[model samples]
Target: MEVPKKEDVINEMREILGNNDYIVQVVNTDNEVVNLLDQESGELQLEATANIFIGGSILDRGITIKNILCFFYGRNPKNFQQDTVLQHARMYGARKKEDMAVTRFHTSSAIYHILSRMNELDNQLREWFLQGNDQSDLNAVFVGYDKNIKPCAMQKIKVSDALTLKKQQRVLPVGMWTGSKTATKKMMAEIDHLVNESMCGQKLDADGFFYMNKDVAQQIIALIEDTYVYDEKYGNIDHKSDMRELLCALEYCTERSGGKLRAMVRTDRNMTRIRANGGFIDSPEDGRTDLKPARERALHEPVLMLLRQNGQKEETEYGNIGWNNAPFYWPVLLTQEDLAPVMFALDQRRKGKQLTIDLTEMLEGVNPDEVLKLSYAGNPIDQFGKEGTTYANAEEAAVETRWLKESVASLFIEKDEQGNWKHNPAVPFDEKNDHGVYSLNHGHFPFVLRDYKYILLRNGRNANAPLMLLELFPKDEWIIDPRGDFDEENNLLDDNGQDILLYGSDVIYDKNMNKTNFEDKSITLWYIEYPVKRVVKYKCLKK
Candidate 1:
């Protein structure tokens, strides 16, 4: 920030350009709008003299740099939301890979992790895109882990869709299928023989589990790749490559590293697919949210049955079900930066403010800290998002974020058959009219939130940040006019915390929240932890 250091930076940039004549300049809000432009031509004026420019977070997004060869970004936020971090990737469209040295991204290790995760997310979304899926289409997609570190809320997959979720539970693969068909035939003929030799007559699991030494597992994976077919419409070669790579790496981590790879094979097809509110595939995330391709499926078949949990009824058969009673995990997970917002909320709640979480609906046999599934089976160490509801520390999210500030402003409202402003009865309202008023009684679904983000992200209307924005809402008396109707002036009725935010929207979205209890009536916000982070982290890296 010092002038002399800035001069040195400019001078170094000039040396890089081999042009002493290049102009160096400092631009900021102090400069008028016209100062950023060439008044004569009305074009964006380039600070050509000084090729190096220094500023803060304000310039992080929106501007395009066509010839930027080097980007040095040092400012890192206390919390790193993926979307915000990706915005600083100003070097996106740079095409000269050979000249990548000229076009480089310089940031800290923490920032690099965020950028890497963003890229992983983009790639996963790309795979879904190739399936002819778009943001507007409702699909049982895995976007990312919610703060509970679970697969974010998904459009509950229809049982009729025949899309069953197959999760490997509480175990690692002993040996990936990599042997030649002849070898596979040989191996299958005497799986016991192969394991007996490796384990001295001991099976990893009584349920037909067997062990294969690292060398044998490696051979099997190589063979699987050599033999796996990629001809099916839903089977992508990339997915196959990913599976083989995963098995190979797992072998390296467990078997090759002199540890046994524990695995189990189940014949039970009665397993229920437990979709967390904002849940995804279970632990050891491996980054692949899509179902295993046919090529890989041939080796590890899905055995979980698709069903709404017992004691829970569908509004319509196979229709979307409320997530409150679905499942839950404990001790909510949050980004490190989210601590402040969570603490802020706790402090406010201490004043007897209604920061309540809905706990009305109970999935039988479910409780906090213990992961619950429909079967009431003990929580698997490897699974996540099987829990009921999870909360996010939205306080860490910046209040100035466009999506956070404008979410209610942009809700898409659909009309019922009667043509009334068919409001979602779930949101609170005044007795006089369906006057929208902010209240703690409201509970939200993760899918709807992600849907908005998905649409906005596609059209460049969103920042692709975490959906943890609601916590930024002021805990005490920050009334937001949900009806979104304001005077022509778009007036602010008050300057205090009770200010009425007058807003109107082109589309009215169906907004609803989790119901705490029918008898309790009032809503209070509460956060409980969930162990779902691994399921997200595992599937990110590519071979």
Candidate 2:
């Protein structure tokens, strides 16, 4: 048989690819092998003495050729031939094909081992990576792969970068409930004690512990009822009358002394007991234990006597039991300036003016529009109702209409003068009240706005303005009239958008006092829309 020409071999290879529908096209027809229209299946198949290149025609197509075995079909030339011909002969062909197969096998095996080792190493390194690069040497030493397939120094550098990238993408810790050891121990002890007390007389083995502790049950019940009475009287106060008297006297003394007498007294007999029983003793060697009784006499006794006199007088005249006699006792008090802003805000509220502070603006520095979006639940109608909708342009009207349909109704209506229909005077109507003025069951806009402002201030924003409003609404006047206003069908009336008007109040002044510069001010105003009803407001008259 005549030797095939180089052109013939090329044409034959092209024909084979074309016949099998695997050929895309061919390129670089000079001396070097270059692929242009290459298609790959599971395996590669080539009938050539020359080197060939192969890949997918479309970059994304899967390789589908199978069994990819190659065999040289030409014989070696006996004499030196042209370099190109020698390179393409059977001897070079077989050697090149062998090398390709060996290289592929080794590369595959190496990759598999690397991946397996990588998983193991990753598991070991996971914690280290999470802790960050604070311990770099430990991370470097612990990272390992098979010695034969060990990554190069460059690969190590890349791996370190990869680790850092992974760490950066990790989630951070949210809120922390951290505390000192003493605090934690105290909390745990309290919880355990509560649980024990709760389960104290319960049955253990069948009618066992409960039946056995009958007297104990009676004692526990009595204790609970008695303690409940004390709790009611003092709230969180430790020594009912004693603490109250001491506190009151201390206040008087402090004011008289221009706050020079800043000392606090413990009037609770329990506190005296603790001090005597070494409960208040921080160390046995402190040497001040003998002075406990003296301190109590000098601090607590006088205060208690003064408070008793005041309480007796109050009881005689007004039949009012002082708050000091309440069950629980919490010794926290607010001074006039401490409550100033709230008083001012309350005054503003009484005069029928919008008193509000945007918390989002103060804390987050977010855009007003974004803040509005966060506060608003849905489209204009959805949040505000059809008539309540505020539109910036006509295009928004259709969208707003669609949004209103999906939204909850917030419209409230009230009869105005001349028997004409009018929107509820309150802005941000509550669904449960006919009148926009806040009652227990409805009128929540002021509360929500106030809370939002508080949160902003709590989060380190300027909350001074909102605090003023808080003073306007004293604790005593916090009454919610659940049954105040309802529709004819007895359904709760929605506040509509008029609930916003609830915040419109001028200045509320103290009923008895005419001093314009009082430390704390209490004022009442008529609801702007419902002028017949008086709303009490508190303010700090300082600033």
Candidate 3:
């Protein structure tokens, strides 16, 4: 009843393989996924397949191929996402270990940099993660190591990737993170020293960041570049950023801004795992190499904590074991105004010049109208009844509407990083989290890594409270039945993660229904979260 069309894909596949024997098929929903086997060859078929299979978005993750000898990934890798790349790394386990030698990675130089960066981060995460597993070490359990950028929870437990980890170099921090008041003051003075020397001729235009000249840029890099000098206890973490990356950034600045580049020496530590959903609990204080910052301020800016040694009671540095000397002693780069005046006059009562400045009060200015609230939008959920145009029940509409108007109050955070807050991240990663890990009772937003324009919060005295996003429409806006990251076995979970709805296998569709995901039979809480700006006026046909 169907005739084959002359498809460009088939021709392209034939040309690529240099053979006329390859097969290519375009699969539609009408053709069930279960029967995607060839009639003659009996090989597994997909949306499209040959000796080489090809697909996009749908093929980005989930499917596990055995003996996938070669990978030809030539996609653009600008702002690279590491989890996506890991998913595409089809070769794994002892089964495909031999396949590594012959397996080729044909990618651009940028992708190479991305991979190098990721691999470097992975090694550090593995080392610290293994150390953190010790429950008795309260310092390790509740310290600053929380901020290290990690791979998905599943990947964190594995160290068998011979290709990425074999003979791996340690990735050291860029500079010292200081916790001492004297150190903070001395550092601020040093910046003042640099400023007096460098800003003599450099004009402060409204266009660039602090220390806006190229020479100053060079100076900052030079100061921090070699600070990773010899350390006995922790050995060394190879330098993270270098002249090459800075030079590239400089070049970009010069070419784009004509003659100026507003540069900033970013003292940041907000690296994240994009695809890993360790569930809606708030992530613990991201550990840093310096002492932890005040709690309230931690929410806005990434804070580096001074950590204890991985295995010992002392801090993770090199000093005479009990003399209280920091193993590492680097200075924090900060604005002179934010730092207390350098303590030139020291007295017995003065502790290292006493730079007792509250960074939180300085950083988090109280914005009177700042809306920490999440917004919700869509077809009136559950309220639409048999009338189709009116409310299913007055009580349902009234309850939902009253709930919508109510606002969520600000949260209470504590010293041990616990509070009346809902984003509790005590949930372990690297495993199944369907019922246990994800709880509606917790008032936290689901953990996801996508760049959402906004967030929403579902309201009401419901069993499960969900976070929401605003202005999301049906077409591409609502990410219904979205996919989750791989589990420990590398198997994809259908019911968990962002926008994923699990229908218990059977899905009978009604063609007349709007394209949002209610057609699927998922038992999970309706944490409705899709969004855009509140100012952008839009409409949904489902309404």
Candidate 4:
């Protein structure tokens, strides 16, 4: 493909502008660049005249355009670098109130959406810093992740613990209980009635599907919150805390998307308590990956999927995971893709030790679109040096199953044969290892694990290990680093699209409790699309 000549570019701009009243200058590397700096004084030089100047990376930084009343940005690169993209905000800075009021930004809808999310993230960071928020008080700094948008240029970043929430992500709660059978039955019936009365007209193509406004969605969330019970000890769930974060993210999205949300009332799922591959709940009836039809219909809004389980009382393979023998509704919140492909820099430090997210350095670049195609499940236990594997026999499986029912202490600490307290051999626990069990659930059981190795290295672990740092995904799947590949410098080797990412097995248990063909063979970084933008403290689960 031949590049268009400068004359052709000037002609096209002239035609688009509709008139040749202003001089069109192609201020590029080949052309005589417009004078932006005084030759001798080195001060800004330019006449207060009306002229149209077009440039590329040259205009990305260290160059200012005066009185940018109307900006027409149309650089359609396949991948966008966040730092370079933000630097193109030459239109920003102090301006006359009247001039600012009249200024307008023009870009494609795709570019506009990502830019809007980036602006929100930038503003959030600025607000926290300006308000004199202590570094210790900070949680995570969120950066909207998009397939087309790269957070920062590759090669520039070496190592980072940046947590990501990808676009079009779904988050569900699996490790939870729905009260007693009677209470669950009553709650389910009441919710069914509420949906029939309020969301009947908003039905989608599916039988139990409906689209709702923020008001109706809030009602449903509240009902689910009231009916659900979570035991932070064995089960890594806290309905109340999760609900709060959900409501917060919902409000943020509602303000932008006109308060639209989708819901599905799936009944009689009969899903097992412990699903394969870290799923809190099983797939939709069609088994087409978390009800793809309903998700596509919403386009750019949250989907509140309510699945009613069969409430089987019989013991599951992993034994009873504390769910009461009663039919209950399981709610899964699917945050929209409009504000995704993001990262959060959370200060998970407790009791003030001085740790901050340097937004400039923490940014990373990866083609998340490629990552989203693979269906990978994260095992939180993997971070503790335990590779996901299958049970050799039912007896071995039962031993691990019993651990799931044990206290939170059992996860990391255990009593030896002599009944002496010792660090669990499974976990490589050390004073230098800065890991915390974050109590925020995003699909995977045991909630999100905080691994701020960089932060904790300086001060070391506290008396009580304070949970910090987390990553959320947009889709139902998780991010995987299967090869266990790292650079010589010990940096995570960026994905080059060669590795095969396995999809959909939370923990590779021996199928049928017998060592079978399927045994987890690799380690992966688990991420779920989480919409909670700010860092909020959740009580440590005590068994």
Quote each prediction's TM-score. 0.29, 0.17, 0.26, 0.41
Question: Cα RMSD to native, each candidate?
Answer: 21.8, 30.7, 22.6, 18.4
lDDT of 1 by residue, 283-349 (tens): 2211232122211321322111111112122342322222222211110000111111100000011
- Which candidate leads the pack in lDDT? 4
> Which of the two, 2 or 4, has more lDDT?
4
Query: How many residue-pair clashes does candidate 4 contain?
Result: 23
For model 4, the superposed segments whose C-alpha errors exceed 4 Å read: 1-120, 124-165, 182-189, 201-208, 237-241, 276-286, 316-318, 336-543
Q: Is candidate 1 or candidate 4 better by TM-score?
A: 4
The prediction achieving the highest TM-score against the true structure is 4
Tens digits of per-residue lDDT for model 2 on 1-543? 344577986897788666663533232242212232134432333444333433222211222222333422222211111222323222222334445443222123223344445455545445545767324321232233322222233332432321111100111111111133343344434433433564466543321111112222223222222322222111212222322222332332333334431111122321110122112111211114312322332331111110001111113221222322222211211122111110000001112233354443343443333211112111222222332223343222222110111012121123356543334345454443332223332323222221111111111112232211111122222232222233332323234321111221222234342323211111111121101011111111112
For all candidates in order, the CA lDDT equals 0.31, 0.26, 0.32, 0.48
CA lDDT of 200 in candidate 1?
63
Residue-level error in angstroms, candidate 1, position 127: 1.5
lDDT of 3: 0.32
- Could you give me the TM-score of model 3 versus the true structure? 0.26
